[model samples]
Target: MRFFLEFLEFLENMQLMLIINTIMKMPTVTKIIYRLKDEGLLDTRICDNDNRVTQVSLTEQGWTMVEKINEIASLLLTDSFTGLKPNDIKKLNEYLKILKANLQ
Candidate 1:
């Protein structure tokens, strides 16, 4: 999900270690990338400018899953707000933020 979100934001190939470094450790990132590649959700290639670097991007199926996930999230959000007035939703959001802060 994190990789898909980053890919969606950039829409470009990224270095494997660089992207993963922002989210996790190097070894775990490599393992996860290999798993994702095996699942056909991602693709990796040797970087053109750096022999030691690997480039990564999402596959078609990964994009499809991202779209479906987005649709589901939107549906759930809309359903959750059903019959709520604008002010009510605003207050609900404020309350949720407070709860989140407390949890954190």
Candidate 2:
């Protein structure tokens, strides 16, 4: 249960960072804006010239929380991949790639 929660945190934290960085750089996405606001991870402001447009920026508390979650996830990842032969590791990676492709 703890591991599952950690994994969830890992996904959420990565997603938060991706959204934050993407919003900082390129074209804005509605999903990112909704997610950030829904999660209370960031704030948004609408431009007057483009009322449909939103600008997103992370809050300090959000950054701190995501950072801690990322740290915990990193620790869990390091600890979880403890025992595996070389062939097993290769097979695992291959299977994961296949699974990801299938999902896409």
Candidate 3:
């Protein structure tokens, strides 16, 4: 769910193939996309230029949901880190970046 929302955030519209490539899995991506569509949070259609390609974009409801999700995430993070000092947070962020890079 987070993956789908974050991916849609940067790209206004994405091809289903691109989503599959990004996720490195077709079945999971297809399932999530279809679920979102069924919930009326995503809009999908076959590309006019290429019938074989499907494109997906977020609906207005999806945008609203994303905003709400972000707000909740922010609050959660703030609460979780309430006892941490600024320097502690900065160091944690630096370590997280290194960990992310190592994983990549």
Candidate 4:
């Protein structure tokens, strides 16, 4: 889950270690990365300036998947709030923003 979200956050190529640090588990992150590469949704290469550093980026297919995932997430949120009033939704949005800011 963290891996997917990080991929969305960093759409361009990013250093492999940076991603691992964000997710906070090298073995698990490495496994997921290998699986994504096997699925042809991600690409990785060694950085030219630093042989010890590897870079990762999403493939075209991964971008398409991200779009679909976002669409589904939006639809799910709308459906979940179907019975809520407009003002209630607005309040909920405001509260969520506050909570997110606090987290940051």
Candidate 5:
């Protein structure tokens, strides 16, 4: 499954409960958030207006890691497709489309 954390780049911060309820429904999301916070990738603080709410934001290290992950993903994708000709890519695209249709 695609991770909700993948879209964290777009938001400044998010509430713990909102992240669990709105973005990820699984109970393990709480564990993941706690793990990220413990690893120092995410910083969590009690909300100013509401002490009950915990706000989570990426730390400097987290942002750096995210950038690196994106860079690596891009490089891996480019390397994987490097030797393919135009027709090869077109045929691969057709196969991907059929695969997607079947999945759907």
Candidate 6:
């Protein structure tokens, strides 16, 4: 039970992390931006057209971190799908698509 809870927590964090990565330079970035900035992974500057607007960019170190994170994520996903038949994989994808469409 404890391991299941921890796994759920990790999965939630992974999903949130991906969402943050997708919109790190927009009108809805998280307050964790400060921590990223402190780590020298994120750089922010004022927009030229609007001094009140802030723009965010990733540093070189940030890009390296993102690449590493993606590699790990790919490994985890690949391992999770190991030894699956091609038809099973296709059926799973189709079910996922149906579920996604219904949820949407």
Best by TM-score: 3
Question: On residues 18-70, what C-alpha lDDT tens digit does candidate 2 reach at each position?
Answer: 54454354334455456656777667677568775554555665666667777
| Candidate 2 Cα errors over 4 Å, as ranges | 1-40, 85-87, 101-104
Tens-digit lDDT track of model 1 for 24-85: 88888778778878988888888789888877777898777777777888899999999999
Q: Report the C-alpha lDDT of model 6 over 1-104, residue by residue, as the tens digit.
A: 22222232344324444544564643334455556778877677776897865556666876666666767778998998899998989999999999999999
lDDT of each: 0.75, 0.60, 0.83, 0.75, 0.74, 0.62
lDDT of 2 at 13: 34
Task: Write the number of the candidate with greater lDDT, choosing between 2 and 6.
Answer: 6
Per-residue C-alpha lDDT of model 3 across residues 28-100, encoded as one tens digit per residue: 7788889998998999988889887778889999999899889998999889999999999999999999999
Cα misplacement distance, residue 60 of candidate 3 (Å): 1.4
Q: Between 3 and 4, whose lDDT is larger?
A: 3
Model 4 per-residue lDDT tens digits across residues 1-104: 53464464564644547746775687777777788889887788888998877677878887777777778888998899999999999999999999999999
* Worst 10-residue lDDT window, candidate 3: 11-20
TM-score computed on alpha carbons, candidate 5: 0.71
Clashing pairs in 3: none
| RMSD values, in order shown | 2.8, 7.8, 2.5, 3.6, 3.3, 9.4
From the highest TM-score down, the ranking of the candidates is 3, 1, 4, 5, 6, 2
Model 3 segments more than 4 A misplaced: 14-16, 94-104
Worst 10 residues of 2 by lDDT: 1-10
Q: Where is model 6 more than 4 Å wrong at Cα?
A: 1-30, 101-104
Q: Model 1, stretches more than 4 Å misplaced? A: 1-19
| Reference-based lDDT, residue 62, model 3 | 91
**How many pairs collide in each candidate, listed in order?**
0, 0, 0, 0, 0, 0
Global lDDT of model 3: 0.83
Pairwise TM-score winner, candidates 2 and 3: 3
